[model samples]
Target: MTTFTDLNLCPELITTLKDLGYKQPTPVQAQAIPLVLAGHDLIAEAQTGTGKTASFALPMIDRLSRTPVEGEYHEIRGLILTPTRELAAQVGEHTLEYGRLLGMRVISIFGGVRFDNQIRKMKRGADILVATPGRLLDMLVQKKLSLAHLEMLVFDEADRMLDLGFIGEIRQLLAYMPEQRQTLLFSATLNDSVEVLADKLLREPKRVAIAARNSASQQVKQSVYAVDNGDKADVLSFLIHGGNWRQTLVFTRTKKRADQLTAELLEEGISAVAIHGDRTQRERTAALAAFTAGEVRVLVATDVAARGLDIDALPQVVNYDLPNQPEAYVHRIGRTGRAGQQGRAISLVAPDERRFLQDISALIGKPLQLQPVPILENGKLIEGGKLPEKKRNQSGKTRKGGANTKAASKAAKRAPLQPEEPVAPDTPGKRPSLFGR
Candidate 1:
C-alpha cells in the first residue's frame, strides 16, 4: 500500500506523479528510490514496465533540485546511458516530465540526427543528460560537453547495452566521467556480463530485484506455433487478420527479415511498417508514432530497433523470428502485458528454431507448449495440424536444404499462404476464436 508520498520523494515529483495518474509506486520505484535519494550506488533488476525509469529519475531530480543552479548555464550533474536512440529518447522524456516542476533541464542526445542541434542544446546546458554510448563518446571526442562535474551515472537497460555490444563504448565513456559519482545500473536481467559490468561500475551497490531474473511477465499468455520457415509470414498474417487485431508488435531476428515481413503484411492489406538500425531517427520516430496511434496495424522491428518502445495496453506480440539470445525473448514479449494487463505472446517456430525455443524455455524456467496453427477453411478460420517433423539423414542429423537454390528462391517469392488441412474446432477458453465473430 506504499505510495509515492511514502517513498520520501520531493513534493514536486509527488505532484507530478499525481498529475500523471500514477497512484502508487511500483515495486522497483518503492524499493530503489530511497537508496538513490540517499546517494547509494545501486543495481536494480526489474522487468520493463515496472517503473524503473521513475525509480532513478525521481530521486535524481530531487537530489539535483536541492541546490538550484545560479545561472542559465546548467552543468550536467546526472548522466543516463541507454543502448539505443529510442531508449535514450524515452528516458529523457520521462526525466523531463518528472523534473519539470523543479525547473530541471534535461537533454537527450543520440545518433541518426544532426549533431549541431545537440551541440547547441549542450551549450545551453542540461542538469541531466540522457545519451547513447556512441553519440556521447562522439560528443566527448568533439569537446561538445563535459562530465567532469557529473554527480550521478545511470546505465538504463544495462543488459540491452551489452546485448547490442556497447560494453567497449561504455568503458570508453566511463573514462571521461568522474569516478566519484554514484552509479546506478538498471537491467531487466542480470547475467554474467551484466554482473561484471556492475562489479566494475558500482561501489558496494544496493541491489533490488522486483522480478525473477530472465523471467517473462506472468500476465503474458505465451504460445508457440510450429511451421516451416517459409510459412512464418502467412501464419502471422493469419493471426492478425483472423483475430482482427488493431495493434500488434512483431519481432524479427534480423533487419532484412523485419523488412520482408513488413512488406508481406502490407501486401496482405495490413498497414505495417518496419523499424531498424538502418532507418534514420525521423523514420523510426514516425513509425513508432504511427504504431502507437494505431495508424499502423503491425510494427515489424528487429530486437535492437524495438528496444525502448513503451506501448500502452498492447494486446499482442508475435515472434516472427526467435532471437538467438534467449534473454532477448523476455525483452521482446515484455513489450506487451505491461502494467498488469493481459496480453498474448505468439511465436512462429520453424524446425531449425527448436533449439532457440528450447534455450528460451530453459532461460524463462517454463516449457512453451507448441500449439496448432490456425488455417482458413471455406473462408472460416480453424485449427490446423502440428508441423511435420524434419527428415533425418543416415548420420541421424536433420537434413539441410540449400536456401539459395533457384527452387528455394522461387518458393520464397511465392504467396505467403499455402494450403493446409483443418484439424479441429477452436477450443473453448483458449485463445479467442480467430474469426473475431
Candidate 2:
C-alpha cells in the first residue's frame, strides 16, 4: 500500500503524480527512492519497465526543490546518461513530467540531431540533463556543457550502454563530474563489467533489486513459431492479420533487417516503420511518435528500441530476428507486459536461430511454448530472411527504377485474403496458445 506521499516526496510531486494517474510507487520506486532521498549512492538492478526512471528522478527533484538554486547560472545539477537517443528522450520526458510543478528545467541531448537547438537549450541552463554518452562527451569536449556543479549522477540502462560500446565514453564523462556527487547506476543486469563500473563510479552504494535479475516480466506470455527462413515474412504477416495485433513492437538483428521487415509489413498493408542508428533524429522521432499515436500498426526496430521504447498498454512484441545475446531477449519482450498489464511475446524461430532461442530460454529460465504459424492460403513466396530484392532482382542485376519491385509491392498490398487455416491444430504435441486470441 506504499504511495508517493509515503515515500517523502514533496507535495508538489505528489500532486503531479496524482494528476498523471500514478497512485502508487512501483517496486523499484518504493525500494530505491528512500535511499536516494537519504543521499546515498545506489546501484539498482531491475527490469526495464519497473519504473526505474522515477526511482532516481523523484528524489533528485525533491532534493533540488528543497535546496533552491539562488543564482542564474544553470550549470547541470543532475546528470542522467543513457545508451541510446530514444532512451535519453524518454528519461528526459519522464523527469520533466514528474518535476513539472517544481520549476525544474530538463533537457535531453543525443547524437543524430542538430546541435544548434541543443546548444540553445544548454545555454539557457538545465537543472537536469538526460543524455547519451557520445553526444554528452561531444558537448563536454566543445565546452558547451559542464558537470562540475552536478549533485547527482544517474546512469540509466548502464548495461545497455556497455553493450553499445559506450564504456570508454562513460569513463571519460565520469572524469568530468565531481567526485562527491551521489551516483545512481541502474542496469537490468549486474554483469562483471557493470559491477566494475559501479565500483568505480559509486561509493559504498546501497543495492536495490525490484525484480528478478535479468528476467523479463512474468506477466508476458511468451511463444515461439517455427517457420522456414523464407516464410518468416508471410508467417509474420499471418500472425498480425490473424491475431489482429494493433500496436506491435518487432525486434530484428540488424538495421537492414529492421528496414526490410518494415517494408514487408507495409507491403502487407500494415502501416509500419523502422527505427535504428542510421535514422536521423527527426526520422526516429517521427517514427516513434507515429507508432505511439497508433498511426502505424507495427514498429520494426533494432536493439536500439529494446530498452527505451515505452508504449502504454502495448499488448504484443515480436522477435522478428533473435538477438545473439540472451539478455537482449529479456529487454525486447520487456517492452510489453508493463505496469502489470498482460502482454504477449512472439518469436519467429527459423532453423538457424535455434541456438539463439535456446540461449534466450536459458536466460529467462523457462522454455517458450511452441505456437503453430497461421496458415496463409495463397502459396505466393514471401522472402523473409534474405535481403530485399527491391534494389536488385533475383538474377543479381540492378533493376531500372525498380519498376517490377514496385509492381510486386503494390500487388502484395492489394492481394485479396482467404480464410486462414490453423496450422498444427489439435496435434498431439501441440502446446496451448499463449496469445489466447
Top TM-score model: 1
- Clashing residue pairs found in predicted model 1: none
- Each candidate's number of clashing pairs is 0, 0
Q: How far off is residue 121 in model 2, in Å?
A: 1.0
Which residues of candidate 2, in runs, are more than 4 Å off? 369-371, 374-437
| TM-score (all chains, Cα) for each model | 0.88, 0.85
Residue pairs with backbone atoms closer than 3 Å in model 2 (clashes): none
Across 1-437, the per-residue lDDT of candidate 1 in tens digits comes to 99888989888888999999999988898899999998999999999988889989899999999989998789999999998899899999989998999989999999999999889888778999999998999999988899999999999998888766676677678788988999999999998778888888899999999999889999998888765677576656666766778999998776767777788788778999999878899999999999999899999988888988988999989988788778889999999899989998988887677888999999999998665565444545454344335421011111132122223234335564432221111111233211222
| lDDT, each prediction | 0.81, 0.77
